[model samples]
Target: MAYKKLSEQVQELSNPQRSDLFVKQFREAVREGKFDATFLTERFTMPKTFSRRGAEGTYQRDTRDMLFDVTPDFEAWFEETNEALAQTRRTGNVKPTAENIAAGLVDFKALAEETRRKMQASYEKGQALGKGRSRTSSGGGASKTRSRKK
Candidate 1:
C-alpha cells in the first residue's frame, strides 16, 4: 500500500530535488515508525534500469579489448604467481598442512568457549538478580506497606 506509493516516488526521481525529498521522507518515516522493512527496502532499492543490469558491469567493447591485452602475458603472470606462492607458503595465512589448521582451530575454539562461558555467567547473574526483584515486587502486588513511627 504505502510501500508501493513510496517505491514509485523513489523510482520516478527525475531530479536532485525529488531524490533529496525521498531520502528525507524515508529517514523521517523510519524514525516515526511509519514504514517497516518492506517499505524501507522498496524505498532503498536501485532503479529498474540499474536493477535489471546484473551488478553493474559494462556492456561495451572495452571488456573485449582488455581481455585480448591480458591474454598474451597470462601464462607468464600465472607462473610468477605460483612461484611467489611457493616462496611465501611457510609464512602465508592459509597453510596446506592439516596439523597447522588443527592447531589454529583448537586455539580459536578454546578462546571462543572461554568467552562464551564468561558471557553466560554474566547473563545468568543478571537474570538471578532480576528474578529476586520480581519476587519481592510480586509479594506486595497491588498492596501498600505500613510505616512505623516513634
Candidate 2:
C-alpha cells in the first residue's frame, strides 16, 4: 500500500472548512502517541512556506518538531482573521471598527432597495414621457387595391 501524506489524509478526512479540526485531531494523536512524529517524516511536509520566514523556520525544521509544538486554538484565530478580513473588505475606512457595522453605515440591502425604487420610478417616468411620441410609419397590414383581374 502507498503511504499517504498527512495533508492528503487530512483532505480525505475533512474539507477546507473543517481542516482545522483535522489538524487539532492530528495534534491530539501526536500528543497521545497514537502516531509517532518521527515516523511521519515521509508522510508530511516540513516548514510550511508562511512559517519558513527567518527565525520561525528554525523552530519547524522537521515535520516531527512542527507537530510536537502546541496546537493553536483555531477558533479564536479564525474569529480574529475573519473580523480582520471583513474590515479589510470595507472601503474608505482609515480603521474599520465594530461600530461601523453596528451603526448600519454600510447597509447593502437598503441601498439596493433604494436603487431599485429609483430605477423603477425612472422606467415608469420614461414610459409616461414616451406616451406623447407618435409613430409616423405603420405596419404593412393593408395591401394596395389589386387591379381588376382581366
Candidate 3:
C-alpha cells in the first residue's frame, strides 16, 4: 500500500530525485521523531574524531563485563565470582561455593579461561572496528596502525 501510494505520488512529481527525497523525508518524519528547535533538544553522540591536539583517550568496551547478559558460561563464572567475593573478609580472594567447584565454573581455572575468552572477543571486536573502512569518500582513510605495539 505504501509503495503503491509512493509510486502514484512519484508519478505526479516532476523530479526523479524528488521521489526518493520524498520517501526519505516521510521515513525520517516517522523515525527521526520530533525535536525541539530550542536549546532543550539534545542528544548524546559518540565523538567522531580525535581532539584538536591529536590526544588519544582510552575507552574500555567491556563486552563481557558484569556477565549478566552474556552466555551461560559467563553467567556461571559471574555467579562464582560473586560467591567467592562473598566469602572474602576484605583480605585476599576467597574460594567459591561447592556447587560452583563441582560444576567447574568461576574457580581459578574457570575464571582464567572465561577471562581469556572475553579478552579474545574484545580484541577481535576492537580490531574490526579500528580497521573498518569508510563508506563515504569524505570519511577518513584506512588506518594501518596495529593497536598493540610490536
Candidate 4:
C-alpha cells in the first residue's frame, strides 16, 4: 500500500490527536490480522533527508533517522544522559556531550528487521488459522452446494 510522505508522517506523529488516531488505526489493523512487515517498514522507516544539529554545530542524522520508536534501551540511555547533564549543570564535574546519547540510541536497522520477522510470522499464523484468505482452492472451479427453496 502507498504510505504517506515521510514529512507528513512525522508531522502526524508530532501532533497529539493525529498520533492517537494513527496508533488506533495501527492497533486495529494488527488486531484484524491485516498488518505485515511491508506495512511496518513503510510506516516506520524515516527518510534519508532528516537530520538534527548538535550543540557544537555538528550535524547528526544518520543514526537518529534509524530509530522508529523510543525503545526501552533508548529510554534508559535518555535517563542516564539527563542525569549526566543535570550533574554537569549542578557541579560542573563533567562536560555535557551527545556521545553518550548517540551510543545509547537504538539501532533502527536491527529493530526494523526483528519487527518485520515477528510481524511476518504472526501474519502467516493468522492466515493459516483461516483469519486470512487461503492460497489454495477450497474445492474446484464451480460451486458444489445446491440452492435452497424459499
Task: Provide the TM-score for each candidate, comma-separated.
Answer: 0.24, 0.25, 0.21, 0.20
TM-score of model 4 vs. true structure: 0.20
Candidate 3 global TM-score: 0.21
Residues 1-150, model 1: lDDT tens digits? 222344343444444223333445455544674434333222233332212345755321110000112232433533443344335423445543567656773465665688899999999999999999999988857748777897
> What Cα-based lDDT does every candidate model obtain?
0.45, 0.48, 0.42, 0.43
Off by over 4 Å in 3: 1-106, 133-150
lDDT of 4 at 6: 28
Clashes of each: 0, 0, 0, 0
Output the lDDT of residue 119, model 4.
100
Could you give candidate 3's per-residue lDDT for residues 1-150 as a string of tens digits?
111222333334333323334334434433453211111122222212223456577432111101012344433543444344345444554467677677665476776788899999999998877666434534775886869877
RMSD (Cα, Å) for all candidates, in order, is 20.5, 16.7, 27.5, 23.3
Candidate with the greatest lDDT versus the true structure: 2
Which is the better candidate, 1 or 3, if ranked by TM-score?
1
Which candidate leads the pack in TM-score? 2
Identify the runs in model 4 with alpha carbons over 4 angstroms from their true place.
Answer: 1-104, 131-150
The residue-by-residue lDDT of candidate 4 on 1-150, one tens digit each, is: 333332343343433223333444444543564433123223343222333555343321311111233345433543443344334423343322456335655555666688899999999998787843454456355777989999
